[model samples]
Target: MVTSNDLLIKQRSVIKFLAAEGCSAANIHAKMKTVYGEMCISDCAVRKWVRIFKGEDPREIILRDRKRSGSPLSALVTAHQEKVDCMIRANRRVKQKEIANAVGISKERVHHIITTVLGYLKVSARWVPRQLTVEMKAQRKDMCTQLLELSTVCPRMY
Candidate 1:
């Protein structure tokens, strides 16, 4: 599959070739739109690349995107997930904010890990697994049976 980066490089190559042939940015952009259709780069981007190719030395032209500076968008590594799971197991009533602080991730990430990754749901202010074990299911059945027996033995006072 052609990834976005590959598509970008392809567009840059075309832009460089056309620029070298002295084609105007407007003409290059029009041709690119016809070939790439909806996936074509913006006209402004085409113009910018054309300018760079025309002004810079051929050897100095960069076809790849530059490195960006900022904190990563996600902290969903296995280590962080394991830490959050351990924290939740240790304290069923743990809050997302507390987990975020302890795990050094955002509260939203902690919530996503708990609900989506770990398959947990909040019940009575505690995090519980979404699926119950066979033993747990049997225990719940027994409890319900006992409650029914008691209800039959002692009818409602009203």
Candidate 2:
């Protein structure tokens, strides 16, 4: 299938060629579609480009073609959010691999939907352990004792 990028590039080239020949936008789109196949270009897209290129104070050519949104859902995602929810609710401790197997999707995809789509999961942050030397531990203990003593108040008699 022709991608939007490819279509845009081809459209620009066709517009430049048609403009040189004094062809109107509608005519240019029809001409290109007829010759280059409808998959490559559309009449409305061509018309929009012509309006921008020829109109006074030419606006940026905004192609109003519907852009594809989001990656195509795999079989796993196709199983429906409800199904995933049901599975998760039934077996909260189900491993990702087992879920993927049950849903016919990759473990990575299973994890992605669990964390991203469901929005009920957290990724653990990488942890770095601190190593305290014996001297440092002793100093910390002494500081705590001194701070506690300093904060203590004595009872007073009338």
Candidate 3:
């Protein structure tokens, strides 16, 4: 069976190729739905790609994601990485925009540093460890196994 993920990647490339040919989002959606039948490329995704293509030169529609210019001024400076770290430490619940403003960088850069460098993720308005420890993962897996067993035994209340 073709996994849904594989289908999605295929759909994205097809959509990108179609968009590059100057097909409108609606037209592309219609064509893909007609040609591929069950593989439904979301309208939101098509629209997003259309907008992205518009920003790029029409003649150069690459199927894959393109790289950005570089990190923002505040993020580019090696000194600012430490500053960003301190800011996040000081306020774990700080917003990306707030960090950007304080650090003199774009919200994207703040996000990059947080994820790539600081190795933190914002969950429920708090910065938390992104990856769980191996032991924690194993414990969570065991808990899930018990939950699955319980569900199999119990009758659905609903």
Q: If both were scored by TM-score, which would come out higher, candidate 1 or candidate 2?
A: 1
lDDT of 1 by residue, 1-158 (tens): 99999999999999999999999999999999999999999999998898789885454579987889977655558898899989999999999999999888999988889999998999999999999979999999999998888888887931
Residue-wise lDDT of candidate 2 within 32-89, one digit each (tens)? Answer: 8777784656677677667666663357654344678987766345456556656776
Best candidate according to TM-score? 1
Which ten-residue region of model 2 has the weakest summed lDDT? 122-131
RMSD of each: 5.6, 14.8, 13.9
Considering every candidate listed, which one attains the maximal lDDT?
A: 1
Clashes per prediction? 0, 0, 0
lDDT of each: 0.90, 0.67, 0.78
Local distance difference test, candidate 3:
0.78
Runs with alpha carbons beyond 4 Å of true place in candidate 2: 1-71, 75-78, 122-158
RMSD value for candidate 3:
13.9
